[model samples]
Target chain A: MTETAGTYGTEFFVRWLEAVAEAVEREADRLTELDAAIGDADHGANLRRGFTAVRKALEEEPPTAPGAVLVAAGKQLISTVGGASGPLYGTLLRRAGKALGDDPQVTRERFAGALGEGVEAVSRLGGAAPGDKTMLDALGPGVEGLKVSFSAGRDRAGEGAAGTVPLRARKGRASYLGERSAGHEDPGAASSALLFAALAATARAEAADGTRTDGEGAA
Target chain B: MSAGRDDDGRGGGGMSAGRVGIVLVSHSAGVAAAVAELARGLAGGGDTAPVRPAGGTPGGGLGTSAELIAEAARAVDGGAGVALLVDLGSAVLTVKALLAEGGELPEGARLVDAPFVEGAVAAVVTASAGAGLDEVAAAASEAYTYRKE
Candidate 1:
């Protein structure tokens, strides 16, 4: 059977997680550097440790449903990450996963709506809004653009991350810095943009692969 | 470490019944244990409430661990509810997350909003006096209004 575009299954979610782990590994130092300017310098290290744990968990159990995949990943993040990002990102995934329910395959629109709920959960958890120089800056816009397309979501999230460069933080550890928080992009927002990028890349890769059976590459 | 073992042993017993427990959460293992010791000392000797420290990462780094927090909460919980006093930042967030998630702790476990050291001291002292969860929490919260002048 051929899986069409705009619909994702458990494998796609798994690949997306894999892509995120790789991207986070590659960009950890950069994220930590940005964090050092406005917040603690442990953002990169914390996320790297969290994602590494997430990767290990996926390898160990490998949930069959997309929602289960996300829920499991979120739980690992909450249990392991040891920073604000842990609960924030963990809530994002856990809420989105719960929204997805047990659906084995989800349309892009359904996924977008679920992701929007996840972003809202993050906002509620952190008590921050779009201009607060938090992950919501990227995540809120990204979910909006996700309603349109994966690429659009990726682009909007990236733009929102960059847009944090000039904003003073109004929440989290950075808020303590007051005026000194400006001129540095929020590390959480930067990592959030990477999430969208991974989603877009996974969708693109799926499209390029075209009409493959689930058992074709089972290893 | 010896204190931890002793606390665990005493906590395993139900002789100190009807007292609220206290858990101190901090980013540093040394800080959490030291504060727990101070609070216990300040609470005085005979029949003091169970006070445990849940601090540092599972790998023993400078960060809070939800798993450790949950374990400590369980360790300190008596028939009365547990009151958790946190040091800073992630400690607060981690406790909130655990509470929001539910089922990870005993029923009625609460995060008391107060200064770390002072709040722990107040909470332990009040709990040792057989105060309920709310009274212990209130005592800790009242620590915020303390005047050093």
Candidate 2:
């Protein structure tokens, strides 16, 4: 397993995005239901549309580099989501892609660092931190845990998303509800958790298929 | 989103070189256009600057679109600058995204932190007077202190 430290390539990213699209499709209703309680009630539908467009764009023009794939997907989401989530998520992916800098393949450690940069960009763009009942709640912890391992990242992201249930919204439209924003998980956090789960799933699939020469050993 | 360019239709000869352009961004297409109209009508300073409305999603729903905001900003940009007044959450974020990307907007485009209607009126009035970007944005921000009481 140590001989096999898996490196991620453009195909891995594309698979991750497709997995995100599928996950968003499967969970859109729940995400939207969560949003209906505290947000605009369109998180599910908006993400569905955005990810669908991303899938289409990726199919029509497959990018050669992992960074290009993420950058293109981010642009698609920004254009199609038609909501605050668009810019926040778009900035995350775009900044991460920029950090990747046309790398055709990256080690897991390098990907984790790039993802950290993406999460930081999101924090700056939304002016929100982990406790703000926003996507950063999930993404911040997820990126941190990714530095340890994929399973650790997924679990931490899920926990961070669930932790938002008790946090009064301090950012985005949910903040408009004031104290009433508590008792609801942030839709953005939920979706972000889904992204991490998809990443984990993609890694698992790649590992099972022996597509990558390196394994998840100690990563 | 809505391709909502209210334009005030006063046939403002061309983009005013010295006057900063104004854009009113809202989640509702009608609301943005109405606000733009009201701001222009209330300004009553004779179409001194272009006031464009960029509102609603591309599907004409009740969400903000970065593409629409970018388009509206470009439409009203007059080489001077563009001052955007956003209504609420996503409107503000969409404009911020465009500005952060530094694309599809004229140089000196700014998001004004002011009340939607009041800020638009003040911004239009000031821009019509051939105010620069700073002056126009300042007038808009000043509306935050406007007291009806």
Q: Name the candidate that leads on lDDT.
A: 1
Docking class for model 2 is: medium
Native contacts kept, each candidate? 0.59, 0.72
For candidate 1, the docking band is medium
- The DockQ value obtained for model 2 is 0.64
What does candidate 2's lDDT look like per residue over A122-209, in tens digits? 8887788779999999998999889998888899999999999999999888898999999999999999999999999988987787
- Per-prediction TM-score: 0.92, 0.91
Candidate 2: give the clashing pairs.
Answer: A4-A214, A4-A215, A5-A214, A6-A214
lDDT string for model 1 (A1-219, tens) is: 344445678888888999999999999999999989988899899999899999999989988778888998998898999988888888899889989998878898899999899988777767788899999999989999999999999999999999999999999889999998998999999999999999999889888875654642232
Deviating ranges (above 4 Å) for candidate 1: A2-5, A213-219, B1-13
lDDT tens string, model 2, B10-125?
A: 23446464468899999999999999989889888465688899889878899888878888887776667789999987788778877877765667789999999999999999
Which ten contiguous residues of candidate 2 chain A have the minimum total lDDT?
A: A210-219
Off by over 4 Å in 2: A1-5, A211-219, B1-18
Best by DockQ: 2
Q: Please give the DockQ score of every candidate, comma-separated.
A: 0.62, 0.64
